[model samples]
Target: MSNTQGPVLVIGATGRQGFATATSLLEKGWPVRAFVRDPAAPKARELRSAGAELAVGDLDDEDSLRPAMEGVHGIFLMLTMMEGVHITAKGIADEERRGKTVAELAAKAGVAHLVYTSLQGVHQDSGVEYYDAKEHIEDHIRALGLPATILRPVLFMDNFATYNRPTRDGDNLVLALAVLPHLPMPLIAIQDIGRFAALAFERPAEFLGRDLVIAGDLLTPPQIAEILARTAGLTPRSVQVPVEQISAFDEQVGKMFAFFNSRPTPPIDITALRTTLPDLMTLEDWLRATDWQA
Candidate 1:
């Protein structure tokens, strides 16, 4: 490791955000240690191939994190909700506990800086159990007395490629939510979240104690449909998916849309963010870059 680039531990390294963050740091010439549940997993093997040191650990056991945290330059803490999209009360509790444990462990380990990837623009409760858990963890991290940067990312464009696929084959992708196509919800590429995380660690003085709301471009469902049409070469329709099918996940997402609909838009200044991370991805940029499969 270079003198400036010490070991940085990345929590949830096997997952989307964590893996991207770790990869970003590695590309920046930082020695990266990936903290994952099973170091032998395929993604873990890939992380190792990409020049990240593997540290086996789980959020449920903070002691497992101690070795990963020991004498680290910084820590990228991306804690999972511990289960599916439809979060429960127990799931919320687990997330909060796990995040707090990471913060406490990082503080105890005497880590230089800690960056937490959190959600943005959520009101009290926000009708989403997971968002509430993130809010709690954010508060806990702030109170930890550790030098920390809280990067609050809006909706991830990666969701479109992964869980929120617009069309299956040639079928019109219908999305059911409380808000209409015109209602703007801040969105970013999950890869951009990683890019921002790396930059935050690199420049602690500017980012420390700051809550950055990150967004690449503001687009609604209909607008997103256009992107899908352009990419997929098929006209996509925007109808709300059935709420009854997904239950709380749908209800919570509906509330999120409603919250976005009623409130002033979040200040995720793209122009300002571009000064540091000039390559921060826009929706079009993401669409062009992604190899969208049917």
Candidate 2:
């Protein structure tokens, strides 16, 4: 079969990173199989319109995943954590179960490569449910001896446009979050991640069995505020709330901020990733390019 004839099975293909990866693969002349919950959903239809073959399957069902993996050349795996929802014990268990199921099935199906998207700075005793669950899944994938490349992404630039974007207070752009304004945080565009995943599959000799922490830019909260302010024609103000206040809202998210705040500087060398994936966006560049109303 030609490299373009692949059956690259992209789990979570309806969502952000998965969609980006699937789109990138298509752009690179590779056939993509998108495994999604509801093929009738609009986003799934969008994938189909974009030329990805749809495979209806639930992440929680290993049996469903089996058929989806048939004749697959590669796999893009991610756990579907409910963003902005309160993390419950059951949610954490479900994430682990679903993530581990995908990993095991990929191995059983003899997938050539499995790309797992996980969080950066995962610690075993991090006391954060989501991050630790990813760590557990990573350990399991490693234990299975599957040829895997783990992509650890930082804070997404998309969050600035959607979930955590700046709010306008009078003439000022107010960014209210849990961490200090000066804490350097790594960030990336989902498209960049997709590009890297596609390149990894194409160059398996260089990427297989690697754990690459990928980011496009590193900027602090206040720096981000200034960029948005510059782009949107407003004064910038940052409200770094107490961890407790954030915890009252979201314990998991609050702990994540505490982790970010405690670490003065982001440890990831984004430059290290530029060799393979270049033209990363800065905060100013991203804000200028985005349409807030969209």
Candidate 3:
């Protein structure tokens, strides 16, 4: 369809990134079609109420995707690995299989621009399953010759709000992942990620064939701990937990930590992205507007 106003199909529209992206597109007056597994889900109902056309589809079923793609101009594709699957079977292999299938199907459907959400540090030879899976998807997207933009987002700022802080109970406390004190990490807000993806679709020609690293701010674990302390009104302490002990924390959490430790370098060009989208939000702005305490 040559009409620029055609709907954009968004997979995973009930989740964080998809919800944000769909909302942004609606606010910008773009017709949005959200692929959801269940039309009865609260999130799906909310999307419909917000003016998004709902399409029932599952990532595990390739045939269900086409109905959403019919006459669509662009798509935002994202897939989450099944929880508690074996590291080999559930983690990397599963992600690769699903991502590849989705990309191939999108290309076959004649999608004009495809925006694939990937992880930061995916291209580096990190030997991590999740990161490797992302790399595999990137490779497949390139091989398909689709007009695509790959967004490698930094660590989620919301992740720290959920997992890093100690429980409200006074007896338990948690610390940072890395053993090295003052080790810096790149982070970005999920809302900003949606904004970035919407802009990529708006200017597909500028973003096509480009791998954009999208990071909001850089901070050490200690700095993050301080932010938590200030935001939560607790005496949060920053301790350097040994990387090997990550598994004891949580299997998937540990694997993620190992991946982070393997490559402690930042990948995105934040300055260049700022040049492209000048109003990008910063961490301070996000925190101020966030309901962390609530």
Candidate 4:
């Protein structure tokens, strides 16, 4: 274990990626400063108990961010999209502007390493709002000449956990709106991404100025369904829904499917990542390790 000592500021610390990265950094003896919108939030308090210094900051408020970035060695920026039932185009623009502002601030603050969590297939000409928003941030990061590392992670396997049940209409696990039945898309667990981010902060020299597409494993929808069934001890079936059915599906789920089906994006190069961290977990391994019954 390398003895790296410096305060790393994590944005959106209450969220999945932020929480995981903060926990990982603390476990590895790194001083973590979490930029949370509400320090009194349950998650923020939990992070405080786990040895993280919480700083009140919102991505939209530039004034609030300076305090968090001051004297930080590195920053982990993961901008979350709006999950509201109804959001306007103006809302999206505001979110993207805030994210870009944060990147610019991190650069101006002279943070040694800026690790940004981006979405996969964003570089494609898909013109999806969510992906395009991320690309806007990435472009700003590159143009700013910051010592940055951008990580584009695929759909999280844990997305399955959000569905009500394994099957919709009796044993049929609804694979809604996904056109690529046999396409082996890449994915990484939240925990693994956290670990990878921590490692990147530690090895800034190697990772700086790199755009890494990261994934633990590549599996098709059917294969994923089989793995889920095997892990949960049930015979799950797979059903493919058309792209047009996306809007009718749960709005968020629909957007996710549309993103996945836009292109047959290839898996990321994990060779450098593997060299640094060999204990990365695959989907099967994660299922085995997780307490499904709980």
Candidate 2 per-residue C-alpha lDDT over 219-289 given as tens digits, one digit per residue, 9 for 90 to 100: 77788777777778889998887999888977788888887777644477767677676666665556556
Please give the range of 10 consecutive residues that has the lowest summed lDDT in model 4.
168-177
TM-score per prediction, in order, is 0.90, 0.94, 0.90, 0.90
Worst 10 residues of 3 by lDDT: 165-174
- Model 4 agreement with the true structure over 1-294: per-residue lDDT tens digits: 533545999998998899989999999889999999888999999999999999997777789999889989899988766656443466568768988898888878888888999978777866567677889889988889888899888767565665423554454444442546877767678888898888888777778888888787787777877777766556656667776675564454466567667667764666656667797778787676665421
How many clashes in candidate 2?
0
Cα lDDT of model 3 by residue, 1-294, tens digit: 123658889988998899988988887778899999999999999999999999998887877887778899899987776565334446557788988988888898899999999977777777666777889899999999989999988878877667554444362234555635555788888988888888888877788889888987777777766666666666667777776676764555566777676657665567777787686656665677686661
* TM-score for predicted model 4 compared with the true structure: 0.90
lDDT of 1 by residue, 1-294 (tens): 232646889998999999899988889888899998898899899989999999987778767888778878999988766557654567778888989988888888778889999888644446666788899888888788889999988888888876776654455544333445676767899999999998888878789888888988887778777777677667667765444444545555555666656664755678888787889888888887887654
Better by TM-score, candidate 2 or 1: 2
> What ranking of all candidate models by lDDT puts the best one first?
2, 1, 3, 4
> Any idea what lDDT model 1 has?
0.79
Q: Which pairs of residues collide in model 1? A: 175-239, 175-240, 175-241, 176-240, 176-241
The models' CA-based lDDT, in order, is 0.79, 0.82, 0.78, 0.77
